[model samples]
Target: MRVRVLRVLDVGGLPRVFWWVWVSTLVARTGAFVAPFLSYYLTRSLGHSAAFAGFVAALNAGGAAVSAVVGGVLADRVGRRGTLLGALVASAVTLVALGSVHSVGLIAVLAFLAGLANNATRPATGAIIADIVPSGDRGRAYALNYWAINLGFAVAMLSAGAVASHGYSLLFMGDAIANVGCAVVVFFTVPETRPTSVGVAGAGHAGQPERAGTLVDVLRDRIFLGFLGAVLVGAVIYSQAQTVQPIMMGQDGLGPGAYGAVAALNGILIGVLQLPMTSWMRRYTHGSVLAASSFLMGAGFAVPLLISAVGHPMGVYAGSVVVWTIAEIGSTPPQMALGADLAPAHLRGRYQGMSTLAWSVAGIVGPLVGGWALTAIGASAVLWASLLLGAAGVPAWVMLDRRSRTRVATLRAAEAHWEPVLSAIASPEVVSAGVPTSEPEPEPV
Candidate 1:
């Protein structure tokens, strides 16, 4: 096991700049103090209703949806490093500003702005990894980056729970500091990774004249759009972890501390198991993995209802957490890798941004729906309904997997030019994305 783990990490020979960027990601996520607990703060400490918190959270998501497009454009145009650094600084400033406001109306607006700033860096971040890491290593590179995110999240949840008692302001202030730290690291260490395809749209590969792509062109892609639909559903299920899950626990009389501990299990499990399981996860098809994730998440969130029926303690919500954590481990790395596969080299940021858009959009829809359902139908019914949504999403993904593989095959059949991104997809065990239409070949230097 140890040897396998070592090979995965060492084979990448991930550059020093990559580690610096990874460290920055860990720092930023570790300081993401307020997001996980925001709904809780609104509902419990501020004496707001679940529905109102959902509205506020939705507003935040709305801002993130807006940022997703702008950030992607900026990353490809100006450069990844600059866009990322700017976003980090803005995120920090917004967080500090958010800490001082007391009026609910003002709070909602600031939350929106914070979401914008906080999420804007995502496309740039993904672009940087692709720009830096070799094709064969990008999958494991993404996995390692994910591990950092969860590791940071584990520490944040633990610390956030402890300090939560002293006043949410402290949490906000700490988060701001962390954002500043992330920005500083980026400015100093992470370099610009925007492809040379900056000016001319779809001209050629990375080293040639810089190309640009319109958001319209990217949106027109039927295959990517279909995948986005699946991602949107998965993102909704995923979003429940922070917003609805805690709201449900609060409904059941569990406090921040207990919810914190239970939630920590998610980050903890991913941090520990994601790397070790990456090799195993590579053995499956993308559609199968995504479909399985959707089902597991639906069932996981509904576990509380089953446990309750069996007279189990509601506190054992850990059962639900475990199932979904497994799903998360299975889905995230491949989901990212596959997006890279589907995109043309020039439109990488916009493509990635659209993926972020799905999550941001899910954030908007999931909370409002989850909140309304919790109020009207009750938490159990709302959760169990997730299973139905998952069931609906499964077939679409299966068909999508087939169609996408076919698309790649068609692209390869022609004397089409190969992009570095596509090369990675053709590697042994084919871990990255874009299923190989023919036998694997060594990527050209």
Candidate 2:
């Protein structure tokens, strides 16, 4: 058992920079008290309606979406280190300011700004990992990062209730302090990792002209766009655990404590099993793992239908949580790694930012849709809808995998087609004839 644990935790051969990033992430997430309890703070502490609370949350999500794009551009242009440092500092300030506001309108505005600052760091962080870690080690690196996030989140959730009982101000202040600490770590340890123009040119597709790294380039990538759509759907389905699941459970007579326990189970399961699962999943393709993840997530939510029918709703709900937690564990690392893998060196930050944008959009859309579905269709329909959405991702990923393989094959063929010409140009005889003698560059694999 000890040996197994050691093997699971052994993310060897990664750079020292990656470990510091992991550490900073863990610290930041551990102090992320506001997001988990945002709704409660609004509805209970701030004397707002549930609808108003939802609106504020949506505003925050919108801010995050917008900032993700901006952050990506900044990371690419200004450098990853600077973008991350600015984001952390800005987030810390906003969080502290948020702790003092009284007016609802002001609070909403502050929440948006806070979210913008908080989420702006994501793309830079992801880009740095992709920049430093080799492709083969990326899955483990991302998995370890995920593990750190869950571990921190578990600690946050466990402590949040106790802290909130005193005053919500403490929660915001704690989060602010943590964000500042994260910034300090980045300032002292993390370095700028954005690739230079020459490096970008060398790492791009061979035989294709170098293009500027921009949103236009990302939007033109059909395979990545499809993957992003699928990510949106999956994010919506996953979002229900926070938005709809607890409400439905409450209506079914489960107490808030029960919901809290179930949510805690999610964090604990991910924290415990993610590393081992990542190790095991290394044998599978990203598509296969994602496909299984989608199915499990759908099935987990759908299982409640059967269990509720049999009058054992709580038991079934717990079981469903287990299933979906496993799915989350399986899907997240590979999905993150795939984004890094698919991106060119120059556009890595933007690609990761686009992925973050998908989740942010889902954050806005999921609750609104889930709430309407619950009101218009009923709980069962909502579950079925979640199931369908999860199932839909399976085909999207399969298609993405197909398209990616086709692109790689095409690139390889292009390389083959260009090789002889390049060789001939590089030959001494050709050089003597005044032709250039540069070696052929291989396209990014």
Candidate 1, position 115, lDDT: 91
Q: Residue-wise lDDT of candidate 2 within 56-161, one digit each (tens)? A: 8878888899998888877777667778999999999999988899888898999899889999999999988877676667888999998998898888888888
CA-only RMSD, every prediction? 7.3, 8.2
Which parts of model 1 are misplaced by more than 4 Å?
A: 1-5, 8-12, 37-55, 102-106, 134-136, 161-169, 197-202, 205-210, 243-258, 378-381, 406-445
Clashes of 2: 0
Give lDDT: candidate 1, residue 71: 85
lDDT of 2: 0.80
Q: Considering every candidate listed, which one attains the maximal TM-score? A: 2
Candidate 1: pairs in clash: 196-210, 197-210, 197-211, 198-210, 198-211, 200-211, 200-212, 201-212
